[model samples]
Target: MPKPANDNTRFLVADVANLEAEIDALLGAFPDLQEDETLRADMLEGETSLQAVLTRLLGHEREAASMVTAIKKRADELDARKKRQERRQAAMRALMLRLMKAANLPKVPLTEATVSITKGRDSVEVLDEAALPARFLKVMKSPDKTLIGEALRAGKKVKGAAIKTGDDTLTVRAA
Candidate 1:
């Protein structure tokens, strides 16, 4: 199974855990500033220190986010390159199969590689679905949602379908 791009990362850097602990201690030492806004003006020095700590934490978060974006971009580039390589490989495999078939050989053993061509299952090509034999077709029960939506959109009375607008959502982002 393929793992997701956003897997957990273990970035070995400065001891952020210790800094977080110190920040927690500072907050614990003066819980009044957060709970009581009036205490903010009174404890000007403590407020300044808290602001600095918060700023540092925010900066660290921004740095980590930027790094994540960079990693995702790099991963996507590598994935695209890998797919291109796989396509080239498939192309070579196709060439090899054609060579083997043209030479009327089931298998050709080269010095560096071996080529083999074998028969695959008979694939069905549906030229006209209506003209297909009963054995080639399978009947199934399903709803035609498109037709139902069209009927509802035209204000026609559909027994099992109704037209309702979707809800609106507000998106928040950097200006």
Candidate 2:
């Protein structure tokens, strides 16, 4: 018979706890069985529940380890591909910038689009905020909390910058 939709979704918490406790007790009694010789002796000499559970757990552990290794290898491959793509993009941008500098005309018209060598607005890099001109230190970004954050760290009360709580996330691993 087919099970209900939520049947698989439901957790057997108590059952898992009972199994864990039983496994722990069994492990405590047969600590020496962790060695290959002792374990092989127990496994070969008896057809028991402990043997079955241990075998199942070991198989699951191996499978989990293999899966984890495969996933990490895949992720590393993806990261390498991303880095290659980023390098290509950067090289293309550099070539475009070189072409713009070489052109005599600022506005170069093409069939589909226009490329302009327009200069971007100059951004001020504050070396010393205390020594900076008050007029120049005016708000460029609305709700800017950078100054306040610095001031707060320097033992001053700043309205915008307060230490906020960090976020929490789950970390999964094999048991």
Candidate 3:
């Protein structure tokens, strides 16, 4: 299933925080002077209008703070979820290696396992000689469904076999 889009409030919160930080940083770097009449007019807009600005600024700051907290919380949750998936994939890879080792077959790296669903052929062959076993080498020379079916019928097993990664599906079934 597809995930829903994130809330738009997050961007607003981030913008508010950045604006606040910039305001503070500018004030600290260049202290205000009372020499300019325009500056004095804006600053001296006391009590009523200044109060409204203060109230709105406070609300924006609160929203920004809350958004930052929420983003951090979501990041931690995603990190945990990703770690769990990695561990599961690692476990499956280990199991596949063990199964192939037991079957007296050369260990096929996950990257080298180029899976395909061909209509005429049902067999698997390791093309790389360094990674290929003698039995698999013989299979590669003559690619046929009959040979593959006969091997499968005799209870011979292939390892790291699946229609897709982490599928746990057998090669015979795919065949």
Tell me how many residue pairs clash in candidate 1.
0
Q: By TM-score, highest first, what's the ranking?
A: 1, 2, 3
Candidate 1: lDDT of 65?
A: 82
Ranking by lDDT: 1, 2, 3
> What's the lDDT for all of these models?
0.69, 0.66, 0.58
lDDT of 2 by residue, 35-104 (tens): 6776745653473355555455455557667999999999999999999999999998678778878876
Off by over 4 Å in 1: 1-48, 122-175
TM-score of every model versus the real structure: 0.50, 0.42, 0.38
Q: Write one digit per residue (lDDT tens) for candidate 3, span 80-126.
A: 99999999999986777677767766644458684232235679765
Model 2 vs truth, CA RMSD: 12.0
Clashes of each: 0, 0, 0
Candidate 1 residues 1-175, lDDT tens each? 2222332312212234444565576568878767776665456445335455545546656677899999999999999999999999999889887877888999878898776777898997778999888998788989898989988888899886777789886453444
Q: Ten-residue segment with the worst summed lDDT in candidate 1? A: 4-13
Error of 3 at 79 (Å): 0.2
Error of 3 at 85 (Å): 0.6
